[model samples]
Target: MGALAVVAALAVAECSGGSTGASPSAPAPSPSTASATCPSSLAPANPPAPAGAAAGAAPQVKLVVPVDTSTSTVLKPDPAQQLQCGKVQVDTKSDVAFAAPKLANGQAKQLLMDIQVPQTPGPKPLVVYVPGGGFVQDDKQGNLPLRTYAADAGFVVASIQYRVQPDGATYADSIADVKSAIRYLRAHASDYQIDPGKVGVWGDSAGGYLVAMVGVTNGDKQYDLGENLDQSSDVQAVVDKFGASDLSKLESDYDAASQQAAAGLMTVVGKYVNGPASTQPASATPATVAAANPITHIKPTDPPFVIFHGSADTLISPSQTLMLQNALKAAGVQSTRYVVEGAGHGDLSFTGDTKSALQWTSANVAAPLLDFLNQSLKG
Candidate 1:
């Protein structure tokens, strides 16, 4: 925890701290089908393990503490402090093709991303943003406000488009696309002004689940598919915002009424794993669902995590985040949890664009988030 710098007044933070058609028959090729070759200098001889893989349980860090009324002054941004809402000068390269995995029909489906590089110094830390769209759609630009804010703060942000259920993509395909994007960025770090050694991931909702998988499965060859095999996809830190962790237990965590409200989403989950999750027996959870759960892959060696979820989320229960936090804690992995009071699923207060909204986010969300990133990636 020495890596993280303390931030004051985090806003009453109660901190606890798919598929269609037939499933893909085999994992994608390691080197992938991209024509580009990674340079020997940049390519790792062997896949690098997660940052703390060999180290024992990370030292416990006190993330939140009781604050006095006077701490409210810290909420006001200093005159020289950069604004977290407005647009800043950033160079963007949109629709950059990173990977092309072969589809069911033997045709290659190209994966794309938008890179936002702050017109600042060189070799800045990179944060890959994966937006959530319920696995049915891909929206690389879904959270522009936060993406720009991070860029303006001197981080290279890449918002990526991955294969979704509509594209006949399964869990394996979507996971592979995300890892491929990480490897792609590292392979071309110089072009993007990225620090290949310091990479992190941030995602919300369904995208949150994907980033968690990426974090837990670090150095796991099974998920490292497509191009840039020479490069590693292991991340230093992870920020999961209300992503479902355990699919098998997802329904049981909800109340009767909440389950009814989330019926459509459950159907999508069934399609995602190509099976019925709710009907499965407790003793016999579906292999696909088990494989898709981030908690299933948690280990003491995994990277540090910061999780956020709204206390009033209905579609996905707050218990889902608790499940992940508890598992990570039990495994001795470094983790911090914050329950945003009165916020619901995908609340705009967490990612709003208005001036007032940004002010709230700067104090409540951005402060701790950037601080954690600084500790994990830059420390």
Candidate 2:
């Protein structure tokens, strides 16, 4: 805010203001963003950041187009910005400035983020996190808890907020926002001083769907147009926790066991499911549903993945993870799948020892997530 840095929640505009949804859409495609709503001063160029920071918010001094814009920019920190997240101390390390490329017709929303670097850095690896909110809920502000954990673990994290379907915007637009954010990162890789090649992605629930979308649609190069850009939005690693993995598969079996786990499927029909939302277009046709799912795209070269789900999940089945894991393995991809025996859809707190961590989501998940990025993107 001081040097013009925009945060994920207060994803400020470039002119001067700031402020900021949705589920997975289609297999995977290049991003196409409309106009941004965040103020210019709030952008990395002339940030008019929020006055009082959220204790739970990530410490972001840099302006990352929030979600849809041009190449991403990293600002330099004043080393004096001290943020307190409950009992944790977060440093908005850098006020790296950036601007969101002007949009077309739609207003831009800020998917604010906070980045944390390692103690000794030639350049630390990056993890761009997408928070979950079943197409109609959750945001960067909601993911404060998990973000702090990632920073303390050492990777330079990017906690993002994708576009929401606030009545006017469609579901596909939300997923497109995810792909757009990645493209921005790829297009301006050097500016963030990140290993463009070694980037990793992570998310929960709806966020997981976004991560999976990128994993399967990694090779499409249509979104990038810059010269130094790799034309590849492929990530090094993926971490999906209790997400709606296979939408088509869910449609096939609306099982009683899966009823609670994958509840929203019912909301589109009758009762038995009551979430924050659900809808059948009063105007559009059935084609929209199939057009907005992420599982439709599954490829071999996408990226290695580490997915976790709660066995007790009711909003989305644990078996959903299996459907995806099998797909990746069938395509000759490597993946680590773990189920928290008795947990539910929103619980990812299962702990496992470091040695057997891959089987759990404890301290083990972070290091392996880091290792996966190193294996694929590290130079």
Candidate 3:
């Protein structure tokens, strides 16, 4: 099957029996089942004391994320409260239409967003999670662990879906969809009880690239498309893990052959640029390529970013992350880089000079990850 066919199949599989748009009430999915689907590492090490407390003496926040195995639904928000962050509900609304595809015969697909809301009501900070599949596969369902963690950490979490390559969508199209989602969330902040100004984005690999795009393109009118034009798509912070910095230049980067091959039969970069470089070289010329490069868009006013990339990753050179870090520094943007030694793409492990590479990241990485989000979004 072609790329579109494979993703279409996955989309069909994803939408099978899943609900969207509204919340699921009555008997919820069993905690055991919901808990089973979430990664154990996502559980909160320290639970928050209560909703109201001193800033200096605040209690550790506990997290609760109910997983929806069958359907995606939206819960009606209670207008009575301000910030709610306990006894959460999980609703995975499949095929919530976001926008039309850029390709012919490309149907406007639904955004399968798993929205986790706290029972308590308040204008909580928001965290949008994007998944990684080389920008060709995978949907909003790919990052339950991070979604659960962010939700538990007290942010309104939305794991959004975006169109991928060969589906008639380029990297620009994907970024536009992400922006639309952010706008959608901001537009309906009251309904979701979100702090519109305190939104953050997180993703891995291709998703990381999208998150970086969101961070770098803040206030740029080029990507504000489809709906919610009045609302800003700017994110306050970004968490990118092993994402490619420059897609157009990937062909010349080390491991270019293997990276292109791993991307797909048709080059993912080619699809992003609308065709193979030979037929449409100008379409992906250095200028156009730089146009899509996140490093090219970094400005002093851009939000802070916390980046993670495996030093030993063979698919994408670690230098991509390094270059991004350097660009952020040159622009005077606050950025952090976690060079995971011996880690590969999507490897959450962060062993620092002891034991094994995969063992201690939970302590060394997850804590800092949470701290960064808390400082950036909550601070």
Q: What's the TM-score of every candidate structure?
A: 0.72, 0.59, 0.70
Predicted candidate 2 versus true structure: per-residue lDDT over 80-158, tens digit per residue: 2222222323333322212122222333333334444434345556787777644444355444434554554445566
Worst window of 10 by summed lDDT in candidate 2: 65-74
Tens digits of lDDT, candidate 1, 98-159: 88787646667666788888766779899999877556656675666566767777788998
Which lDDT tens digits does candidate 3 get at residues 238-260?
99877878775442443333333
Model 1 Cα displacement at 189 (Å)?
Answer: 0.5
Name the runs in model 1 displaced over 4 angstroms. 1-88, 275-284, 347-362
Tell me the TM-score of model 3. 0.70
lDDT over C-alpha atoms for residue 61 of model 1: 25
lDDT of each candidate versus the true structure:
0.64, 0.46, 0.60
Best TM-score among the predictions, by candidate number: 1
Off by over 4 Å in 3: 1-102, 251-266, 275-284, 347-361
- Give the range where candidate 3 is weakest over 10 consecutive residues by summed lDDT: 46-55
